[model samples]
Target: MIVYILNVIIMALGLYCLIAKRHIIKKIIGMVLIEYSMNLFLILIGYRINGLAPILLPEMNRVQFSQYGVDPLPQALVLTSIVIGLGTLALMAAYAMKLYEKYRTFDMSEIRRLRG
Candidate 1:
């Protein structure tokens, strides 16, 4: 309950940074924060108290495994999301670097004003 609320707060903070901050690097950091918070939320959704790993041992019956095993789907989804986020972060960083090289500033408003 509390964890979920904290996750939402983190996401909101990230969104605020993305929308309210004028610096490109701050925006990039905000994007990262949002991604991380989402990943955390997904992981929380799949968590079970005293849950065992999703592996099936020979001694464990199907019903027992089903009841105790942690969900693998959310974990797999998070892994994929992480890879995608890394690619997006890299692209954003490259774009920011190019912008800085051209305008000598990371401020988005300054960049906009300098554009001809």
Candidate 2:
């Protein structure tokens, strides 16, 4: 619904920042934004109105649980993606720091020009 559209808009803004920004830090921020929006989208996909957690209890019938439970797969996937994204973000920050140490600037264009 509208939430999906908003998610797409956020992702587009991240793409714009990644493509149009000159600063390395800004690009890293953009990457993180895109990662977060994707995680949100995955969570939204598994959401259900009036849904309960996908847990089974002695009183709950199998049919009712199947009909009412929100999906757990997407949630698991998002969790995995978050961990992977954190690792990627850390690697990117390390590279940025090294670039700054060498070039004295976070501007990507300047870094390219200074390459020897």
Candidate 3:
């Protein structure tokens, strides 16, 4: 329940950043936040209380193993999400830098030159 609340809060923060912030860089940061929140929510969905790593060994019992093992799918998904997020963040930063160079400001409203 607590984790669900936190996830909701994280999503709300990202939405607020997207809606209220005026800087292009801020919008990119908001996008990153949204991505992170989604990853976190996915991880939380796979979490078990007092869960153990799903490694099979000679000492492990089959029943306990199945009951206590952590889900590997979410971990894999989170890793992919993080890699994609890193790539996206880098691209956004580079774009922001170019925007700054051209407009000399981070404010989105002030950088509008192609308005039609």
lDDT of 3 by residue, 22-116 (tens): 98877988888899889988888998899988679998899998999889899997999899899989988998999889878999888878554
TM-score (C-alpha, index-matched) for candidate 2:
0.91
The total of clashing pairs for model 1 equals: 0
Question: Please, what are the lDDT tens digits per residue for candidate 1 over residues 1-116?
Answer: 99999999999999999999998999999999999999999999999999989888898889978998998999999999999999999999899899989889998878876546
Clashes of each: 0, 0, 0
Superposed on all Cα atoms, model 2 deviates from the true structure by an RMSD in Å of: 1.5
Model 3 steric clash pairs = none
Residue pairs whose backbone atoms clash in candidate 1: none
Off by over 4 Å in 1: 57-62, 114-116
Residue 32, model 3, lDDT: 83
**Clashing pairs in model 2?**
none
lDDT of 3: 0.88
Query: How close to the true structure is residue 34 of candidate 3, measured as C-alpha lDDT?
Result: 90
lDDT by residue (tens digit), candidate 2, 63-108: 9889989999998888899999999999999999999998899988
Off by over 4 Å in 2: 57-61, 114-116
